[model samples]
Target: MDILKSLGHPEELINLFKFKIGGCRTIMPKLDYESMSESLRTCYQYLNQTSRSFAAVIQALDGELRHAVCIFYLVLRALDTVEDDMSIPLDRKVPMLNDFHTYLYQDEWCFTESQEKDRKVLEDFPTISLEFRNLAREYRDVISDICHRMGVGMAEFLEKKVGSMKEWDQYCHYVAGLVGIGLSQLFSASQLEDPEVGQDTALANSMGLFLQKTNIIRDYLEDTQQGRAFWPKEAWSQFAGRLEDLAHPDKLELALSCLNLLVTDALRHVPDVIAYLSRLQNQSVFNFCAIPQVMAIATLSSCYNNPMVFQGVVKIRKGQAVTLMMEATNMRAVHTIISQYSQEILQKVSVSDPSREKTLHTLALIREKSTLSQSSLQSRTHHLSPMYLSAAMLLAALSWQYLNTTAVQTQGTGDMQG
Candidate 1:
């Protein structure tokens, strides 16, 4: 409902309005409280508190699928909490990570592994476990399997440092790729997405890697301050003496070199994401997947050649995110977004930059893989005036009330709906 209180800036306010108008249908779905069990009702409430944005997506999902996805997310969030908390020494932490899956069956089992920040989620583990235990066996299998694999991966990385880009990819696959794979399995069981498409390991891993790398790239300062380093030593060591050096004010230039290098490396996964998305058949599943990919590209574009990664958090604008959430419904729209951001990054990369060739080559691959011409991208992204878009959204709301479906394209004049 009223999500605007967080918007203090003009850009954020404007984007919030646009999102409310254009994304009302997808963003505001009817909650089936009548069907949710008591435990589920509590779990969904906790989900909203923990992640308001993700709650929007989960609630938008249909039927039992929504509840299943929420529990799966919380289960992983708990695991990640254990892994992220540096205060937990390696000895206790590794076993906690390895045995996390078993805790699902133990009612009221909770561990204070992470810091006080994640204390509530850990404390509430029993509630989440109860909900997970109640899910369909297929859903339970997917969640448990992914959690087990992710825990093992976390434990493995805890024992050693990330040495190379290969290790980096492996770590990301364990924590995030497994989540993508598990979601695909759940989607298949729910009959929301094609099981075959979900089975594409390379593409699914890339999907998770793309997003994870973006977060890693963005969180350099936070992760470093927390005394955790995820950017591969091989990659960052080439640019600076230490990973933390990238955030040093005196080493700003070298820091940016390291930042660009990582961003370029992350760009390698774009084609696989595009390929994976092209195979998706379900509308909600497509929208769910595409929105984040669009945001990732947009964030990468903002992060590229920007010195903010060293200083603090760098993010895509709220308006841009809202626009992507509303418009990124199909593969074509996603491609155009990726292409736009790819060009933004390409323009910033100079021939003299350390990773210039890799950056240029990776971005070019993204552009070529898009299969959309510049003219198509240009034509597709052109928007009617803001007033017109708002009007179309109004017409869309009216249409959804009657016809229950309206085809709202990203740009141009029309009565739009999702």
Candidate 2:
């Protein structure tokens, strides 16, 4: 029924149908939960409880790299929980952030005081830290170093507003870009990817910045309501006296102008994203990285010049997200998705908008880089009629039901034999 509702988007409908009928298993293989040690199992539990989006990809990672990345995410999530809890005084919060890395080594160091949503990771710190210590020496070093650096960076920003574009970049580097760098390093240490993947810090930083900027743009209202400001004063000051003013109904037009400008700034990192993804030779790693980058671009497309950004949350549709998860498995498909969404943003550009020229120039560069050849473009065009999509969806639904019934019957038969 959801697929039927998305019939207008035939590609998304088809992808949704495929995803519902076990295609996701092919893309994201399940891990052996019962086989893991108690601490690692608990860590995985904490991971899923903390972030569903990341848990799927992290589990899909190849071999020991999966465990490494899972522990890495839980560690950082615990650190972020500390930073997010506004009730913590500056002196205490700053020390926690700066010393977050050391806590990974302490057996009984858990912070049960945090009121943040994901504070369970902190409360169960021993489980997460024990798993962290079990990681290979190289993985531990990489995760610990990145955590320490990121903690200090978060501490520095706690006392400052994002005053300039450079500061915005710096803040994102501390919070997110460093995560990208650490992941790349872990990929290398796992020996599953090239050492150069970790060595390319600039491209890795861009990957993180692109996603971070998009999130900041999309979360304008939520951030403002929480008394948190991430949009650089250098950008928002041009259109409004205060960042919160942009949320006023009377300032909608100017708010959109400010949004467009930041979106353009975020788009500047696309070429680097392309370069970074192109260097990835591992399929699992590529899927893990590519899916999020494509989603960020799709999200940016949704938020571009859209007034819903300030009024409330703006997010990509579920069908669209499913399509991206399926299609972004390869570089050519990534290029197509990026090209398609960048073109969508191009169509929405306003001539009188404050960031018109900059937006056009950045998008043009992206199009030139991502544009497929004529033959490739021709092969990608799907002209499936709505009738066919509906029929396909129906068949997929029936197939799904049959598969579940067969699995149940097989289990019953095994029990009877036993």
Query: Cα RMSD (Å) between model 2 and the true structure?
Result: 4.8
* TM, every model: 0.87, 0.93
213-321: candidate 1 lDDT, tens digit per residue: 9999888889999888899999888877888887778887777777888899999999899988898887777877888788888888888878888887887665556
**Candidate number with greatest TM-score:** 2
C-alpha lDDT of residue 277 in model 1: 89
Clashes of each: 0, 0
Local distance difference test, candidate 2:
0.88
Model 1 whole-model lDDT (C-alpha atoms) = 0.79
The candidate 1 region of ten consecutive residues with least summed lDDT is: 409-418
Local distance difference test scores for all models: 0.79, 0.88
In candidate 1 the C-alpha lDDT for residue 119 amounts to 62
- Minimum summed lDDT over a 10-residue window in model 2 is located at 409-418
Model 1 residue 378 CA deviation (Å) reads 1.9
